[model samples]
Target: MTLLEVEGLRVKIRTEGGEVTIVDGVDYAVEPGQVFGVAGESGSGKTISVLALLRLLPRGATTSGRALYGGRDLLRLSGRALRRVRGRELAMVFQDPLTSLHPMMTIGRQLSEHVRIHEGLSRRAALARASELLAEVRIPDPKRALEAFPHQFSGGMRQRVAIAGALATRPKLLIADEPTTALDVTVQAGILRLLDRLRRESGLSVILITHDLGVMSSIADHVSVFYAGRIVESGPPPELLSAPRHPYTRALLDALPHPEAEGRGELQAIRGLPPSPRNRPPGCAFHPRCAYATEASLEQVPLLRPVGERRLLACHVDPFAPGP
Candidate 1:
């Protein structure tokens, strides 16, 4: 079943200069037990798009879209109704666990309260569940760990705790926004493995948002490459990373260090900065940094249409076309 379907998601926030569109007409769907990845550079609206779906955007931000989940439009849900869905049916783990977890509160208190509110469990029951959750996420001595504050744990362990909290309600859909950010490579791999295991075991759907295409290739079944605010290319990670049709996706892949290029030279870097939301280019936002850009790319906005099996691309020129 389609877990969540978002169509024409547009986010506009009032700035001193004027209202600027952050996410423009974004569309995607998440299937049950599938890992849908959203990848892009910083300030590309990947975070803001999901934030809008959860109604967690900053003040003065307005969203227009249809985020259908369980036959209801999440964007149009009442505050009370949305609250019930937020941490129960849908939960999220933020990039930084330290900021997400309370500094003063013990892990036990936080986890217990999270489940208590959503599941209506008694204090004793909630605490026990909290310990079980910690253990489920592979935290050693879960009971003792729960008594310690967020600061007491290492960066990786703290992230595990955050993931535990997000899973406390047994949400069907989990949104992890840069869950492995700031962690060591080993820790990052561990977190990704954990997520994959949980999804496989529980049939949980996930929306994994990050700028790291390498990470996306690791666990994401499907990846949507975001530029500025729109999805430029989307396909299965294996295919998308191997033969990207979009110039932006190709540039991103080029920026990553490859084993084949070991000791070859420095990695390729995408030129120029992402356009500011206030003054995005008329056609494609990535045209400024794209090496394969042409006059058509600068003058016309290409729609995201299917080009091959399970692949969608938004581009003017065919990267695989023969030279003139």
Candidate 2:
């Protein structure tokens, strides 16, 4: 079943000078037990898009879009309605646990608080449930861990606790925003595996947001590559990663380090920096950095065109067209 759907999502932030668009015309869907990956560089609006879904944008930011979850429009929900849906129906695992978790509150109290609010369970019952959740996330000796504070746990354990809290309500959709950014490779793999197992066992839908193509390739069923404020290309993992069509997507994949080519020479990185939101390119946002950019690409914007069964490319030149 389709657990969450977002279409024509546009987000704008108000600055001293004027309003600037950060996310433009983005679209995607997530079904039960599916993992959808949103990949892009730092300023590609990946995190902003997820924040917009929960109505968690800054004071000066405004969002317009249709975010349908369980037959309800999230964008239209207000006050109490949105609150009820946030931690119960759709939960989020933020990038950093230290900043996300309450430093002063004990881990046990933090976990129990959500259960009490969302489930309305008694303090005793909530504590029991909290311990169970901690165990579920593989935190050793849940009893002792609960008594400790955020600083007491290692980076990985703290992240696991954050994940545990997100799953406390057994939300239908989980949005993990760069959940593994601060962890090492081994810990990152463990966390990914744990999330994958939880999704399969509980049939929860997930949106994994990150800039690492390797991480997405391992977990996501469908991948969307974002540039500036728009989706440049989207398709199944094998197709998008192996045979990317858009110049920006190709450049991103080429930038990935290959062990085989390491000894030959230095790696080739994409030239130029990403365009600023305050001053985006006129036509294709990536034209300034794209190697295959032509006059046509610089003169007109390209819409996402159907390329394959489940593939779409937003580029002026059709890379798969008949040869010259």
Candidate 3:
């Protein structure tokens, strides 16, 4: 079943020069108990897209879209209506727990407060639930950890707390934006495992956003490749990994470090930086960096259209098309 659907989601921020669009015409859906991955490099509008869709953008930003959750348009929801739905139905765990978590509050206090607000439990019950949540996230000695402050916990522990808080109300959909970005390799694996287990055990849908293709390959059921404020390709993770059809997606995969290429000196990388939002390149934004670009591809933007069963690509040229 579809848990959330976003269509034509556009976001703009008031810049020094004027307003500029950051996310343009993004569309995707999350299904029950599925892990949907949004992958892209930094400045590709991945984070801003999700934040704007959830009405969580900071000041000077605005969003427009039909984000349907449970058949209701989230964009049209009143602040109060949205608040009622946010934590209980759709929760978010941001990239950095240190900044997202309150330093002054004890771990127990933070989690219990969130539990009480969304679940309407008593102070005593909420506190007990908070400890249970800590256990759920596999934190050792949950009760003792609750007595500590945000800064008292290690990076991995703090991220666990953030996950526990998001799962407090058993939200149907959890948006984890770059959740493992700050963790060490080993710890990053553990966090991804926890999220995958939660989805399997609790039937919780998750939208895991990150720049790491390795992480997505391991945990994501389906994946979307975002670039230059648009989706370039989307399909089952296995398919996208084995047979990426878009030039940008191909470049991204080729850029990953290979164990066999150890003696190759410098690792492969995509040339040129992603275009700045304020100074977006004309036509297909990726044409500047693409190896297969042609004269036709430089002057026209491509719509994200279906190219196969459950697969879509937005590009002027098909990498797998029959040769002349």
Number of the top lDDT candidate? 1
Instruction: Look at candidate 3 and tell me the lDDT of residue 177.
Output: 98
The TM-scores, one per candidate, come to 0.97, 0.97, 0.96
Candidate 3 local lDDT, residue 35? 98
Instruction: Write one digit per residue (lDDT tens) for candidate 3, span 272-320.
Output: 9999899888888899998888887789888889987799998888876
Whole-model Cα lDDT of every candidate shown, in order: 0.92, 0.90, 0.90
Clashes of 3: 0
Clashes of each: 0, 0, 0
Summarize candidate 1's per-residue lDDT along 1-324 as a digit string, tens digits: 899999999999999999999999999999999999999999899999999888999999999989999999999987779999998999999999769899999999999996888778999999999999999999999989978999999999999999999999999999999999878999999999999999999999999999999899999999999998999999999989998889889889888988875697889888888899999998878888887888988998889999888999999886753356
Q: What is the lDDT of residue 230 in candidate 3?
A: 94
Which model, 1 or 3, shows the larger lDDT? 1
lDDT score of residue 178 within candidate 1:
99
Off by over 4 Å in 3: 260-266, 322-324
